[model samples]
Target: MKLPLQALDPDLFARAQALLDDEWLAHDADLAPVLPTVLARGVGQDWHKAGTFRHHLIGVARSLALWQQPRAVRLLGLLHSVYGNAFVDLVKFDMATERGRLQALVGQGEEELVYLFCTASRREFTQKVLAGQIEPDGSLPLHTNQGEPITLAPDVVAAFLVVSMADTIEQWFSWQDDIYSRFPDTDTSRQQKVHWMASLWPGPMRPSGRMLHQINRLGLALQHPKLKGRLPMPPVFEACTAPFSASDDAAAASLYWSVIQQDQPLADLDVATGVLEQAVRLNPWVGEPQMVLAQLYLSAGRREDAARAAESALQAFCSWGNAWDKRVQWDAWIAWTRILLQGATTDGPGAWPERLDKLNNVALRAGA
Candidate 1:
């Protein structure tokens, strides 16, 4: 599940809606009209008007409850998928999926933002989990070959677990209901088959299972506000063995921090190549590792390595998208730009002047 509140099991939507109504939403006419557009495909073949705003509402509302002020969550949840969906094709991914392409066209920072709320919502979802709130899971696999547990706050985890359940209820099960109910007692009826085919092979969703999930969550939260936040916390496993070593807050932090703070901390994208090498060894896919390594190389006056690292960091950030911590991705691009500028100032290497021009141009565009 992508968000914790999505799994509230009962009345999730009603409670979330009620809380929102009483708190921030407060019957804002300006926002209500836009709800249908966010779910414009207009439902599935079931004639259920499936993908109405209410479905996504439950998932987003529950997830945001952890950290988002009611108003902000209302806005973020409502707008999260406003641009692109089965029904709404407001944004396009025609843009390249790599940093070089985006940076060339839009410059660094703007490119990062473009990818953030656009297609990178996955990243934004995870950021909540990292901040100790319950949030959703993502395809961004922890390359910790050992699958180590990353500690997060309980309430945040609850929110994420719920969101994940809602995703299953609204996005998955509701999308293909018959397949789940197929008793498959030998041959199936053509009508049933066509009914299933028409259900999804054509377009968007049906709101069957989603409503139940919302109702279930709301009921649970209202009844047991205290127990509503309970979720089993799994321990970080040794990546190589999947063996658990029960970790408290301090131990996990110490181990993670040791590698990060080693050979000199990678403070705001200013680390040496040696430092980056260690970081990449420990956490290779991390965006900052590559960015800082690039910065470190540029500082030591190594042009080729610096360029390569810049490319890696940019590509990493872009592919991951902004859905999960869009701000951090922007910071990566800015940091790269700063390094490029520094190189040009020092007469560093090939096409330094061209790089400088592009850097300034992107900065101007991004208001950097």
Candidate 2:
């Protein structure tokens, strides 16, 4: 069995609904004006991961906004891949024909940033920058698909890196392990399937070592003493780059959480709970362990503990730069955690199947 279920508390539901409404309203406001243009370009109709391409685009923008990036950067993020890049060939807007139209929508400066992001060799740029290959003036050497060289000013390099970090965080998940399949890109031996279908299909699951490695590397670069004033370091970068070593425990916790998610024996719950508890202690800043611990507590009839764990999860998520699982956005995670809060505080028992159904439905709808 998974977590024990409980009826949602009515009062808690009202509070959650109000909070979510406000959050969504703010998010919508952040996307205004440019959002319409994005929709008109058929972004909403294009497929991406477990959701529409528009959803991914919006997610990237939201990440940038959460990091307190400027409006132009957020706009650049929203339209980052519209012209198609080396990674995906899904072109929502043709650069040759629609550049002027998009420039008019988000302004020339923001559109140019998007254009650069789509046309430049992002992976190569990232590698070079991380390797400290920047020019003396802090300019970045970039190349186009045709191997044409381009030079990015220091400010532009900073902005490009910020957007690149958000883009990775928005879409990377364990299910897409194939992206890191190159010889040295990832150590596949260190990765494990977080779900039954994780290796076979695309879905929400824990990120792999390859993903974390990329994130940490980017975080380190951004956190470097040199870039301090150049850009605002994303909160996730700070958390992940903190002077703490919880890698071993965190990896163990991930495996335990994965097993807990499966049709495992009941005897394994206690062991998994202990592992997760220790993992969170080592690094309370990480939300996944606390979220899983809340589930375990709820299953064991520890209502108060479950409530606290859920609250902690919410707090951690607030500062987290990306969704723990890429199948849904961070807002959806907030909604699910609120439900957990209600269930933990409520008194009546409920069917776990119903609760799981509700979550699944929300994820599907949100993805749509």
Candidate 3:
């Protein structure tokens, strides 16, 4: 029995296989000819989540697909993630520790080109870290000790931006759909997602705007021939995005600042609270409004209010993560939170805060 050729990447191969289920791997068929080019045309036909530090390689391929890459510079669009995962360590700023099989598939020029992509991707993460917008703790952290901030040429920035946008559009579904499938109808899972969102971020300045843009962009892309298979989403997504119009986001954003921002005061606490309530109703699933309101209470030095808000944030945290390069930052944040909590509560078995010896003695006596 002859097996059909397939792209090396497990995911691509699996998807290709599913697309041609009528044929078997043991018997080569029409899909045979399609597989080789699929593996050859792009970054190669494979990817590894752990090996590939970030989505930069995918971004690079996206750039190539959009004709952003010059002829000499482009080799395989599919080989995007091969470098970081197998050739280099984008996060560690080092060559990959393991060079098992992929080393032979891609040579020096191809590898060097991939390195350029990695460097460019690192620059993006670097800017975010320097701005204190993203925390560095993932496989995709700051790349090098470049004495100081590295300035990129304008063209590179444009290239990076295009790749970044395309990468995110692909990831929103690629990454999250996996989560949805795993925990389809779990309340606890949904609440955890909501909690995560609340704890992190300053809160949504424009939920409706974000959703509207995402939905519209996705719809537009689906109409294109290249993105045909990847375009459509579950019908429920429409219901999810029903209220994310520009007008709705603008109104919610206006209502939010009315209550939260010190620079702008439009009403009393009650009125501000009312605006938030309306905003929340406008987009209940989003975590930002709840967070902002909670933060507002805390800013006024309201301890209970702060706790309540923090609790809400925790409950709403999304476990699946997103493509805006947000997960690494949050993973860092959660680690800090764990350390702070342990230190604060470790006063020798006290009720939050008490004499260490006394608290220990009380516990000892209770046991007796």
Candidate 4:
């Protein structure tokens, strides 16, 4: 069982409370009626070996409030995990039988947001929104478990991003606590969360510049020395300036690669590789698919294939106008891969470490 908030270290509790207060939530009266019930149900529940589930929910809500999101959005953050969303499933509340009560407490609009969030299919959302599949007017059509398509308005998408950021930030903070020691699989989860945020940053539904700055600050905070090795770093590359126009083959390749990253069965590795080959064939000019293929090859210990894919990435990066500004990032990747290949091939003086240090210095200087 977790200690009560009051029992936490005074300074730590104070710092956490200060962070929460920064979100400027609505007056307590608005949340008063529902607070007790939420706390009661979440009391003994653990949130991924972090603090209590109630605490995580509160942190998310506070984060949304900090982002100055609308009341409905804040409430949605508070209730996001109650019905088992894509990333987490701490279902202390049943949505089906308790809709009216929840709606009555949070208002119809807020309740609807919670319902949509809880029922969204994570895979489809990633395929459509994160992969840049949008309607001409910039709306993303998300499918629920029932196979019904719901086109999200731009404002709703913005709210969703805010809530998602809050949830992810809270999780990252939890990873800093000793209770949630890093595990082998933790990096995959961290990567997916950061990738979602990075991909959405360049979308039409992006948050305000100020909000984006705040999100970046939170990301940087996770890089504190103590937490640096425990969590996956956010992508160093800037988001694509234009929306992706991936062919079906490319999209399928991305989907397969996503599955592989999530620790899917070994059988999926061959399928992912084949799909990536098809992607490269369908769109030889796109650097992203080729880069992903390189990573896949590297993971399989095929250094020669990895080197070939890295060369292709450089070629595609040079020819792809959308990647013009990302040359520094691509250069860093190429250099890193070369060092790996060199280390594998030579038993001479270990200059690779020095080269790697220089590479890191260059990356830091380049603000990557």
Candidate 5:
């Protein structure tokens, strides 16, 4: 049968099939009967903004199998959304309604993993796991469907990591296929997923070092070949490198203070511009430094540089999504900068006052 993902990206579909065949899942006696049922459940359901739920299930299972995870872990990945987990709600099959049949098919161990993956509260899990809120004895506090606290066993935690990584990496590739069109809100959802994956490090319930390393490598390997240099480096892996050592806000602030405190003239602007450039390189998602650079270029009479910086700021803002206050601020800055560039090109600096007045009006209206 033609998989839904085959129409979206033939290369990826082939890769998934290759992995499944290599793992012998394509011919597994236990999985053969269950696979059709799982696919049928997801026949018309969408998964994220990419392919159907069946595609996601198969993709995640293929990823886990390729990673050489235990059979139970791979099975968990295949059925992770059976009970409607936080991020996905396609199947909505209740364990209480069909636990015996599932357990009989995949065994109790794999069935339990599926139930855990499906029922765990994502918000609570992220808060507890990412925030270093585990108990002193090293158990991570996770909640069951009843909202009661339960400690995850070390092996279970490890399995969870494998499933989570497989699920996230699959989704990441799907998003990358047509990022803007798939996600109209921009890359905000993608960014959140990357951040969550990145934050898994230096924690009690963190995945093993080997698993983390594999995840980093897998993330790098999944990038769209054409978007290699156009998009920022995958945030999960980039966080491990040197140049991204300092946060963008911190780096930008340090540069701003150094230049402003010295009251440097426009001739010395190169020094400040170098720092701003580095800041953007470190974290292109943040727009503050780009906007600041645009203002500096405008003051220095570099119309082209100012316009480019402003455009970069606009792109960054759009990528960050539309939080109301930030959207207003970015819209004002973008409008003002574009108007300044247009006026400079048509009438030279002689029209500065009139352009400034127009910008002021825009700011006032945005603020209001």
Candidate 6:
């Protein structure tokens, strides 16, 4: 089967395939090693948005990886806001003093991109893209901190937009909206919350507002008459812009978040299962609802249903981004899905030990 980014970035797509073939997250060790042990202390502790800074960072990097972005863009996503920006005020690295330290870690080129990403006005960049304001030479006009004007080269614009898209998708969630909203407690209704967040952004960027804005920008770029050969259209661009309705994501997120918040969520298995079933149908691209449904099915001894759900969950994680749950990496969720698959696939209690050995082998060779 032709994967999402197979044509645009064959090597990265192959890396993705290597990961799925081995059933482990280790295949992308090339990207993971850039964030060394020295920098981990700060990023691992700071709180950002709805989760820890480390989780958000890795999630953005993984999102870029899923989109089959080039290594530099992926690295930029990983360390995008370490120096802080307009949206978030948590700075893990000092701009003036720590630039050299970060450059030593991720190299000068990537560090520069990260600095640009952190210092530039992402809101302005987003607004320009939405307004179709790209210059004929593909230059993007932006302003850095304190409104210093800067125009990005065409090549730099492409890289910046990709990292920006990944960053927006990785962190923009209803939970994120609630975190930054004044009336978070007051807006209890699902539709109300979605509408409230949607109003904060531009156009029909509703249900999944931030991501939809990115999609809109990409769509305009793809169709732009002047950008025909100048702007490169990524392979995952098609998949990301696939036919997913606004209400689908809205309802799915509402249901998924509500259920997971309960005191003893799985205690009422029937209700939980039904809710997840609807959620999975509404937004099949997300894996958590399907993953949880598989768990519920397994507990109910519905082996066939459990196995099917687990497989679907794996497919979803492999195909697209999943920022529904920020606490865990996409690979960790894939491992959980495989474990559930093993439980649902095994014949009896004796088969458990044999499957366990296979799982270990897969994990060990995932990077190979």
Best by lDDT: 2
- Against the reference, the lDDT scores of all candidates come to 0.37, 0.65, 0.36, 0.49, 0.50, 0.63
Which one wins by TM-score: 4 or 6?
Answer: 6
Backbone clash numbers for all candidates listed = 50, 1, 30, 2, 0, 0
lDDT of 3 by residue, 200-290 (tens): 3333322223332343332332223332332222121232233245566446655654554543445545566556667655543333455
Per TM-score, what order, best first? 2, 6, 5, 4, 3, 1
Q: What TM-score does structure 1 among the candidates reach? A: 0.28
Q: What are the TM-scores, per candidate, against the unseen true structure?
A: 0.28, 0.75, 0.31, 0.43, 0.44, 0.66
User: Which candidate do you rate higher for TM-score, 1 or 3?
Assistant: 3
Query: Against the hidden true structure, what lDDT does model 2 obtain?
Result: 0.65
Q: What shift in Å separates residue 281 of candidate 6 from its native position after superposition?
A: 3.1
Off by over 4 Å in 4: 1-27, 173-368
Indicate which candidate wins on TM-score: 2
Cα-based lDDT at residue 138, candidate 2 = 69
User: What local lDDT does model 6 show for residue 12?
Assistant: 45
Candidate ordering by lDDT (highest first): 2, 6, 5, 4, 1, 3
Better of 3 and 4 by TM-score: 4
Worst ten in a row by lDDT for model 1: 1-10
**Candidate 6 residue pairs in backbone clash:** none
**Given candidate 2, what's the lDDT at residue 120?**
88
Q: Write the per-residue lDDT of candidate 6 for residues 94-166, one digit (tens) a residue.
A: 9999999888887898889889888988777766776778888788888987799999777677776666666
